[model samples]
Target: MPTENALPQRLTPVLEARFGLDGGAMFGIIPQPLWSRTNPPDDNNRIDMACRCLLLEYPDRNVLIDTGIGTKWSDKERSIYKIDDQDPGMTDSLEARQLEPADIDDVILTHLHFDHVGGASRVDEQGDIVATFPDARHWVQDRNWSWAMNPSERDAGSYRKEDYSFFESNPDAPPLKLIDGISEILPGVEVLPLHGHTFGMQAVKITTDEHTFIYLADLIPTTSHLRAPYVMGYDLQPLETVEEKKEMLYHADRNDWILFFEHDPKQAFARLDFDDDTPRAVPVNPDEISAIG
Candidate 1:
């Protein structure tokens, strides 16, 4: 049970699929030796990553942040990314909290990347990909929606049409709400658009009277990325990513915002410490804050 000073009763982290990415690509120009010390790479030079989502439970509506990589991968594709077969995935995570997909009222997709939004839909029994949360209204940036529909050559592979096309083709599926720029989708849930990652990838900011939690989607994928220059090579605009990260980090440190990492493998939530020249992500035990279920 959570104490009075712990995380608000409504927030929990919903873990999804586990996958791996190339260490070099993940850390960009950072030397292998420097990054390998913390995030040791496997024989295949891949580092572990987790598709962790944030779930906000409310009396009237339940909200879910980015869904993980869905179960639509072929064996070859799974092998390429080194996806862990043992991960209990989204359904199990939700069941642990005594909720189902239908219970989710809104889904704020940080972006349309396969790893982030893949679980938004699934392959139905009739051999068709369908929306996973039939009752939830999916929210995404309009700029990002257009970019994903027609991605550039550099990031074409990241956008999987099958993962989200169902929302457009199937009228029975829940509505896909596309918003422009930053806006409050819900009363206290606001989506801030950041372009350094993809085109218009948004980071979710959930504010309460006493706490402010920012779901740092791919902007700051992991705790290791706390350093300004440790930007991912996967980012389209690496320099832009550095500036964006620095600004976000400064504000997060000053305001003492709890950052929810989407791709961090081991650590789920962290608070920034700016005592040193560089800001560091001090991992906070989810149990201490009652932030994970």
Candidate 2:
């Protein structure tokens, strides 16, 4: 269902998987009953989560943003995440769009977290590690480049040695690490970095003559987090997230920005609003997402 405005845009999903984790863990300190009303959980107490990655076909490049959790996990790990080897999964979505593994030109990682960057690599014929996109350059922020290579003990799980070893081995593969501030990676698109959840995590901002849309990455995981105080516990600096959201939402409200959500299962883009000028979201379905904005 497209919005009132027709934005001719194509969004391909690299993955479509669900997880069952504690509802409390999903929304941090938010009360269970209130959040549950919006997102209900299962018998195991974990709510169904959507791990979606987007592939954008710009005129010149096949730019993909974020790679959902890859299939490099063990049976034990699979059981832990409750990985469903069923329909609506990553491969299914890719095939539906008539895309193959080698079709991607560039993988734009929003951050180094496992869920975001896992699909960056895949195992090859020789049992040797290899980049998922052999011909595509992998993009990351300069600050996060070092941070991921040398992650702290507390965050080591997010950057597994096995996953990144492929990059270290492939000397010729392009590494599109950002060298300057607020750079443009695609036409009519800009990378705006704001640190709160992870250092150097950038939200892609795309503007057209008619409207503006910002891919509010993890900044606003779901519409449930639209309110300023709904920062996730996983964020390193919650107060910083508050400030960042305040600035983003203020601009979103004034400019009538259509925000593209990363983790929201049903809706991808939304036009933001607030009864009292606070940050809120109006769902924008795929049909409504125009190439213009």
Candidate 3:
């Protein structure tokens, strides 16, 4: 196997969906004035965020990282989160690259939160919920699945049973692979679990030749969340999130990991930098990237 920081043979960034959320809740303890400067909010104090997913084109399989907030919500529900219906979604995104949902062989869900796993399934003409990627195996942590089955009062609202009900209702549905601990779920793709945000929220570490790309799901949703203490109030274990941020940031800086953000509006892929002993996330210009390495 290649060593750390290996670059991938092929990778593409796909913007599946976008939403606007309350700025205060997104930044948690950070003041609006401070966070708003980098991420300007709308008239209602809402910040724009993208449900971006990574598409890996390998010889054996085409893998998708997260499925974004899907089209399963009522108009009222969409209005509440300010989900943009005009934007191209997961299917549209895949079509742009000359591929269909059926072409996806695997989907690695960071967790089962609506925004992250909503697109995993969708409603058909008969109004029955079905797996969006009909031929793909959806991978999620066993611990996280158990927690979502019986969620705590604190996070019950985030767990929408309707989104994943297809799995329970269909006995012969597409495969739902339950993973355990950190392992290479796919060739060169490693899943690392971290608590504090949710029960088993995971970050995907992709090893490419001479480069390591980390998909920061909710662990560090946006660039503004680079600071250790700026964790979201939505986190089940806020303090644990903070601790994980510190350790992850340090590891990124030391190893030159390519950090990918799932929710940042303008910035998506970046590298961790340090100035005067302070760690910071510096965005990478796509033009500068010749490959995943």
TM-score of each: 0.94, 0.87, 0.94
lDDT of 2 by residue, 1-293 (tens): 53323331455544456555566866877888888888787776676666777777654456677877776778988787676646376667767767766777777777777777776776678976677777777777877766778877866766776766556666755565553447777665678787887777888776654567787788888787888778877777788888998898888888888887776656667788787855667877656545522
Ranking by TM-score: 1, 3, 2
As a TM-score, model 2 comes out at: 0.87
Model 1 alpha-carbon miss at residue 69, Å: 0.3
Candidate 1 Cα misplacement greater than 4 A, ranges: 1-9, 290-293
Number of clashing pairs per prediction, in order: 0, 8, 11
C-alpha lDDT (0 to 100) for residue 115 of candidate 2: 72
Best by TM-score: 1
Q: lDDT by residue for model 3 over 170-232, one digit each (tens)?
A: 775689998888978876899989988998888999886556889999999998888887888
What is model 2's C-alpha RMSD?
4.6
Go through the candidates in order and give each one's C-alpha lDDT: 0.87, 0.71, 0.85
